[model samples]
Target chain A: MKELIEKYREIGFKLTPQRLAILRFLKGNTSHPTAENIYRQIKEVYPTVSFATVYNTLQALVDRGEVTEVTIDSQKRHFDPYPKPHHHIICIECNKIGDVFKDYSDALKLPKNILKEFKPVRNHINFYGICRECQKIGGIKYGNMSKSRAGCREF
Target chain B: MKELIEKYREIGFKLTPQRLAILRFLKGNTSHPTAENIYRQIKEVYPTVSFATVYNTLQALVDRGEVTEVTIDSQKRHFDPYPKPHHHIICIECNKIGDVFKDYSDALKLPKNILKEFKPVRNHINFYGICRECQKIGGIKYGNMSKSRAGCREF
Candidate 1:
């Protein structure tokens, strides 16, 4: 933990008590938490924590490569601590994100035509699936369903 | 277009004017527009357009497998008229998303362990790169950089 603190200090992070609390919470977390998730967890310990502080600190960490944002869920941004390169698998039914550590860089070659227009940097693959729990529960709403059922009933 | 209407109606859609307008807008659109983007466009032709209407239409379309939600951006959901199964390439500098029509499914087999826990449904790959325009401009911020400038400056 000392090295983590020193690393942030070297990077000029203010490391306020709240920030420290956030760092502690995210240190080895693997849940792929959202901003609100982080705020709620931190609030349990620091009741006075503001959402802005959580957002700012999260943004700072993300900017410094300490956290990686998982774009698997369109509804909210999920943050993962940056340990190494990885991808994600999301449960379509429950929205649970699981880590995929195997690297597929060798197989992700871009088509020559697209390569001409854009110089490729990196890639992330989102594998959508039915988690065991969701499968067991027969969950089929697929959360993105529009709130109105005005005349649609097939789903 | 008549066939499209018949398709949705067969599945029990109401075929309201606003819903039809949104459907026509998305019939073959490839730009991967967000809800707000669609809302603005529809509002021009239908002054009475409501966000709820747009969102509801989108949700209904998504639920019925008529539209695919592109989860490439974390900020908001972008919808693609469910043309076919495909992938995407995003310009890191400008955040412009492009479609990749090729399929890589044959090579994306999951490791045995994960496959056992979750049944894979589909996969979408997001290729990050610098678009031609951004390259001409010497590239703007990559946007994912952690806020620290301590030892990381190469992004």
Candidate 2:
């Protein structure tokens, strides 16, 4: 926590008590919480905390490349504190997101035409699937098994 | 045009004149326009067309899996008329999105733990890059060239 405070201080980010609380929440967080998610959690401790405070702090972090804005969810934007290149798979039914640490840069070659048009920087893969809980809740037993098996076969 | 009308009709989509016009504009369009983009274009023709009509038609098509709602651009949702599995590379500077039609399913093997937890169905790669035009406009010549060259070296 001291290192975090010092790091943000070195970066010249003002450390309000509320902002500190937010930084604490985001430290090593892997759940990929949204603005509202962070706001609700922080509001419990700081009852007077406004949503704008949380949103603006997050935006500041994203601008500095300290946090990555995950856009896999269509309804809302989720934030990841880790900005390092990685992948994410989202559960289509429950909207749950899981991190994928594997790298596939070698296999994701852009076509020659695209290579000529754009200078590619980084790539992220968004995988969509149904979680086991959702599959059970939706009573999709044998149907999903065959589909997932076929998907595995393709790999 | 006739085939598009027939296809939507065969799938039981109500073909209002406004909806038909929207369909005509979307057919074979690779631009990946947003709803507002479509609305603006449609408004030039049908001044009386409400935004709700365009939005609702899109929602219906999305519900039926005829259209894919692209959430890459955080500002607004872009719609892709083609529902076939594919990828996209977006220009970070201008937010211009381009299509990538290659299949990387084999390369994206999920971790054993994630595979166990989720029944994977499909995947899409979101590549971030700077287009040639943006690189020139931003005066970011040699800097991005090295970064992109380094990126390509990884592949």
Candidate 3:
């Protein structure tokens, strides 16, 4: 925590009590929380923290490469404090995210046509699946319909 | 267009003219448009079309596995009409998304720990890099700072 404060101070980021609370909450956090998630947790202690403050602080962290914004979720942005490169798997049924540390760069070569158009860089994978609990509870619900009635049903 | 209408009819998806317009816009579309993008384009032809109509139609398509929602952009959802399993590479500078068709499934094996917690299903990779245009325009700008001045700079 002290190191983080010093790092923020050296970076000229104005550190308020609320921002400190956010920083502490994010340190070593593996939940891959969203801005709203951080705000809800911070509000418990400060009771007066605004959502903007948390959002801005997180944005600053992402800008400085101190945190990574996980874009796997369609509805909201999830934040990762770990600086190392990694992949993620999300539960399609419950939106639960899990980290995958294995590197697959050796296997992810771009096709020749795409290579001609754009230079490749870092890559992250999003695995879509059901968690053990969700599997036990409901099993696979979508995409397993009779062809005659498949397209018409609403998910 | 007739084939698409026939497909929709066979699937029992309601075929209002407005819905047909949305379907027509998405057919063979590679641009990976957002809901707003589709709405704006459709509005030029049908001024009375509502955003909700477009959004609802998209949700229905995604539910039925007719379309894949591209979650690469943080601000809004982008829709890809192609149904084939593939990956995407996004330009961090311009947010231009390009499709990557090569299959990396052979190399993306999950670690035992993750496999134990979550059932393996499907996977998609999101590659982050500067596109050729952005590379020619500005080169890399973020994460290249002096240690003394790095942490303080805002992107």
For every model in order, what is the number of clashing pairs? 6, 0, 1
Tell how far residue A15 is off in model 1, in angstroms.
Answer: 1.8
Q: Please give the DockQ score of every candidate, comma-separated.
A: 0.66, 0.66, 0.68
What does candidate 3's lDDT look like per residue over B98-155, in tens digits? Answer: 8899888888889999989888899999887766666676655544321222222111
Worst 10 residues of 1 chain B by lDDT: B146-155
lDDT of 1 by residue, B108-128 (tens): 888887887778999999999
Tens digit of lDDT per residue, candidate 1, span A84-137?
Answer: 888888776666667787788888888888998889999999998877766776
CA displacement after TM-score superposition, residue B56 of candidate 3 (Å)? 1.4
TM-score of chain A of each: 0.86, 0.85, 0.84
- Error (Å) of candidate 1 at residue A31 is 1.1
Between candidates 2 and 3, which one is better according to DockQ?
A: 3
Q: Record all residue pairs in model 1 with backbone atoms less than 3 Å apart, i.e. clashing.
A: A62-B146, A63-B145, A63-B146, A63-B147, A64-B146, A64-B147
Candidates sorted by TM-score, best first: 1, 3, 2
- B94, model 1: CA deviation in Å? 0.6
Grade the docking of candidate 1.
medium
Q: List the residue pairs that clash in candidate 2.
A: none
